[model samples]
Target: MAQYSGFKQLLIYAVSMFIIALSFYQWDMSQRKQEERIHETQELRKQPLRETCAGDKETFKHRLEDVRNNELANLIVDDKHGIIYCYIPKVACTNWKRVMFSLTKDEPYPDPASISPDLVHLPNILPFLNSFPRSEIKAKLKHYTKFLYVRDPFVRLFSAYRNKFQEHNEYFYQRYGRHILRLYANQPDPPQSLKEANASGMRVSFQNFIQYLLDPLTERNEPFDPHWRQMQRLCLPCLIKYDFVGHQETLQQDASQLLKILMLQDNIQFPPSYENMTTPAFLLDWFSAVPLEDRRKLYELYEQDFRMFGYKRPRELLDG
Candidate 1:
């Protein structure tokens, strides 16, 4: 009877070991399938961009001449991974810039969160597509895994205004904010300095910023500040065939899929996003300051961006 008990214990141990091995094999298979699904989903995100670019030949006619220095300046390149990210301002670009900087380091990349925001934006920190010769630029554009993120044109505009004008951003306040105040705020004698402007409680309203955008002189004077420039103009979606087109609205999922597509899901993680991101719900209050005529005209200005990036026209604001 004692010998029979010892045999039973041995049998139980063997069964337990077999179950553990089987579970590990199943887990490994599940991980691989999940990775494949992520890659497939990432590819699906580019379909809309392809369809839009193919149909929009009229916009492409001038692409050759339009591919200027400024146009290529935002295309941050990661040669190690063969990735080119066309970053649009106010479109989670800060975090993307951090990621680009982290890629430039040696193996065992530091966390993107560890990089300073100011350092990432410094032009010297990252190599842009424009810095390369025309031949190399063309080669990289063709061979690299190019990607860009877009946002609702108006919402992005509002966010830019709120950040630059509403907040105490001295650089923007000096360059564009002052001009906006002087031109549209009916303040011919606007304050000369941000400190003075803030001290007196003089601020550029959302309506004033919209007026500046609609004004012909704005672009004629110079390209719209990248912060407020149309995503189409900045990224030139028609000029380049981006493998992935992410939207700011779905940033977390899109960023995740993109990392998986690049096979960096295990190596790096996207930085945590802010909770109070701009939303469509806030449009009504913001647009309350904007007149209907100006709103329609503004929509016309960015109509191409709306169509190309699959952003629905805000009928409520435009119609009303």
Candidate 2:
């Protein structure tokens, strides 16, 4: 806790480099979505293709791009105080960066990466939220607002599997070779359930996720790594330190309130503008893409997240 008691102070004083690392990562992300998975391996086939608007590739691509390019980047709301935005993967981070960089009132130097190390008191990239840890640091926020955003678990998990693990793409394929799911018509497993395929680790293969899932059992015998079973355990402990929790399911509304908390009420609105607003249909498709059995596992795994954030379990979303 840095002591500002406002969002602006947190942003202005945040470890800006994490945001830069995030931004830099996104620059490479644009191409990932459009590229074909023709060169995929066996494990890459564990998940199926996202449910588009009846195969509306052009529309889907364009809309996703719009969200990534402008909507996400433009959703910034100045808290007018030093703010710390602990970014969660694939949760509209780009827009947050654009917003943070635009703080004209008492903004830091033009370059954020340079100042981020000092602010966060870290010397390297965040690696994973686990190793660096957030719990031990919240007590220090007495001077600044400690904030982080969360998303609907179903939405977030589906987006991750549907999108080829966005930030973790290279790792997913490289580690799990034949175990991961791909879009290839000839894939061995072809987007099967995690229970069936036994996916876990974070390795470049689908097996990584399976191994990751099985890591808990491993701890009694071995330890888990590159696995959600392990990573979730690692990060769950850190989540306790977060003082501000915003939900991604209600981005526009949540972000608006966040800005107000930081004293930027007049400068922003609830539900920031998304130029190509996604229809409720897309939201439905997004949830429906995942297989029901796998979804139940995911839902159970993320039950804490769903329950903690007040997310209503849409029966359609669950059974879809």
For all predictions, the C-alpha RMSD in Å is 2.9, 21.2
- TM-score, predicted candidate 1 vs. hidden true structure: 0.87
* Stretches of model 1 off by over 4 angstroms after superposition: 1-44, 61-66
Give the TM-score of each candidate.
0.87, 0.44
Model 2 regions more than 4 Å off: 1-82, 97-138, 165-171, 176-178, 181-243, 264-292, 317-320
| Candidate 1 lDDT by residue in tens digits, 1-320 | 99999999999999999999999999999989987876676556556556777887776533545577767888999999999999999999999999989999987999999999999987588999898888898889889999999888888888887888888888888888888888888788888889999899999888888888888988898888888888888888778888888888888988988898899999999999976455566877789778999999999988878877877899988988
Write one digit per residue (lDDT tens) for candidate 2, span 94-167.
45554555453253324333233223223322222223224423323334565555555555544555445434
Q: How many backbone clashes does candidate 1 have?
A: 0
Winning model by lDDT: 1
What's model 2's overall lDDT?
0.43
- For candidate 2, which ten residues in a row score worst on lDDT? 41-50
Superposed by TM-score, candidate 1 places the C-alpha of residue 284 at a distance from the truth, in angstroms, of 1.2
